[model samples]
Target: MPFKASGRATDYRAIDRFDGGAGWIAHPEETMQRASHVLRASGGEADGGAWVVDPVNADGVDDLLAEFGDVRGVVVLMDRHARDAAAVADRHDVPVYVPSFVDPDVDAQTQPLGGTLPDSDYEVVRTVDWPGWDEAALSDGETLVVGDAVGTTEYFRAGGERVGVHPLLRVKPPRALRQFRPERILTGHGEGVLTDATRALQDALDGARRNAPEVWLNGLKALV
Candidate 1:
């Protein structure tokens, strides 16, 4: 499993294209399989604009974003996920938005995320605020975008889950996410869960602790 260091991706594979927008996995062949998402949202003074979340740059991504609308801002949900955020924000001449509690080492100018995103209906939800891990989620009831609290990747899920809590957090799943009953769940890793998303999220959180052993065993099997 090659670790994708924080920088521009050499190539990427697009996935999870939906009505709102699309997502892509940088270095898709890598085992970690980090995925980034974008959403076309509107509110307040703006009509429609694309908000890139935890992005990893690759060819044709700009064109993909263009299909949605103008790039409004780049959002970093987790403190450690500054992957290509500054680069993408700089390219679009927008500021990188992060939660006020986090202070990532990106070069671009940043704004504290709160309330609803400027000109968009997406609301930020504080998911985790631990010593080393800080994360936030975005939602508008129908679509939910998460950082590291949960994911759909092989590393994140157990045997029967469409989405699963992160291995480290499974023992104590983030309670804040239970409030959302989204029709689609977009994650910062792996592909989004497009169908049965609400049930998937509920199951993931409700079963996280009980399934921790299974998840651990599955990880061991993969390593073997």
Candidate 2:
């Protein structure tokens, strides 16, 4: 079954809820299995305000945001993942933020993101910057949020990876991500890795090339 986007989600499943953050998959049954996240500013000026990332609009998404506080902004980490970002940002009356290195082809107003996420400790890490592929990751030392370059989805993993490099990138995994040792990794697809995330990430990067053949086979099976 090829991946297909669904209409506005009627229901969503919440996941990765921590002290100051939470995540949800709006279209849980969709093959793409895209997930969105909200991270609240812990102690900064933006305290209580939360940032939404790669959102896919759902019926009660606003209620989920209310749990953390006000919605500050909507962030798009992958150029191709414009998803419901603009619509969500408009609904929240906030700006849509795209990484400074990314020139998304979406038809919406966007703010260039660089350095740290405004009002939060999350620092933007440029993960991929090739001609057609531009992606970014965010981390505040503890929780790591990635999009596209890596994921926990069935199509993204091989035999026993808690997380794995995106199948297309398996042969040349993003080295920029090797620097962090996050306690938990939230992705744009599938569920997050909440335990032993550091080792899971390291294994994914270190074994990405070596496991390419298996990943390819897994991806093929997923498509069928």
Candidate 3:
């Protein structure tokens, strides 16, 4: 589907709240909302009440909300710096939990999904996934928020290889799942949501990388 936060024009205003929001990513990809992330506050009573922080480009975030409603528990599938997810947590006043590889400052954070959120201003809650925490499963929505691990700009990369050409739509490597069967994927840059061509690519990549161990090893190797 075309980018739309429920038909709302791509909103740069939401991008202004993060650490160096709009200007943080100065690369050419940055011009098109690269490195930007998706802010998702968790909901429902059965699951943790925290939010999901997937760093997607402007269009991805917008279309994601439109397709699946607000996110309620952050799931970071990559280790790339996710545009200061803590700031996003603070914006919604929720806890931020990211993958361990994300290199976050968990000492300053907490779990937002749980109601025990401290009275103090929002801090980070870096979950540092030692085991797989499919927080997205908590939501009735099938949408998964995978920071930069999933969608990204056309030519966005640090070393000189754009991930679009890489085997998987992944970055910062070291993956766990052999394939991501997200009904809808919100990329941080380039085309935000994946439904048609992007969806087909996701399926193909998932099938090729069924060797979870090798896929993760390759991803980590690429980053290292």
Candidate 4:
């Protein structure tokens, strides 16, 4: 789906929140549509350093920092998903990592996502030739964290059931993402897949491939 203006967007309330074993994900209220995530190294690393992804609620900042220990980095998945990132970064005195292709409108200083993560636990992959946005995802070999280049809203189910790509993204799934065999997927929108992540990703890609017309129509609507 095209990015809807925030004015028309519903306020998200938390629905599900948990540590995805290897990582932590906080689902936005009510909808499995969006979330704030923290990617950390195994064994909790001594420094507790972590990368924050597309944070939304400022009221929960203290709790997030507490859980993650220290914010080594703040990342905005796409320009549209920069919500609360500036505030969160400023609160922790860290730089916001954005895609290199577009100018970030947030107040904080911005750095390119590449090789900027506090540790090597995560890698940023930019989605090339994506329509109307410069998008990216964070991967740690076993997990993939994303804002919206891919999503699970369309396929969401109760009890943390696995979901597929955002309806809009089914038109053109990025090959960069397809290459990763993530065991879990932490998504900005949609409840995350805590199990069978690699298979879930492949399923999402297959669903997109089968829904080419729906994807094309969504893309055209965004243009109009």
lDDT by residue for model 2 (38-97), tens? 888654333468899999889998898888788888899988889899899888788899
Best by lDDT: 2
The TM-score-based order of candidates, best leading, equals 2, 1, 4, 3
**TM-score: the better of candidates 3 and 4:** 4
lDDT of 3 by residue, 71-157 (tens): 444443334443445545554454565533344444236442331212212322232243432212111133433343433343333
Model 2 score (lDDT): 0.87
All models: lDDT? 0.85, 0.87, 0.36, 0.62
lDDT of 1 at 101: 74
Q: State the lDDT of candidate 1 residue by residue for 88-195, as single tens digits.
A: 999999999988876777899998888676666688888997889988888888889998888887778888999999988988888898899999999998899999
Q: For model 2, which pairs clash? A: none
Measured on C-alpha atoms, candidate 3 has an lDDT of 0.36
- Of 2 and 4, the candidate ahead on TM-score is 2
Q: Write the per-residue lDDT of candidate 4 for residues 129-216, one digit (tens) a residue.
A: 5557677777767777777756665433212325555555555667777788887777777667777888877766767657656545
TM-score of each: 0.93, 0.95, 0.42, 0.75
lDDT, residue 171, candidate 2: 72
Residue 96 lDDT (model 2) = 90
Ten residues in sequence with the least summed lDDT for candidate 4: 20-29
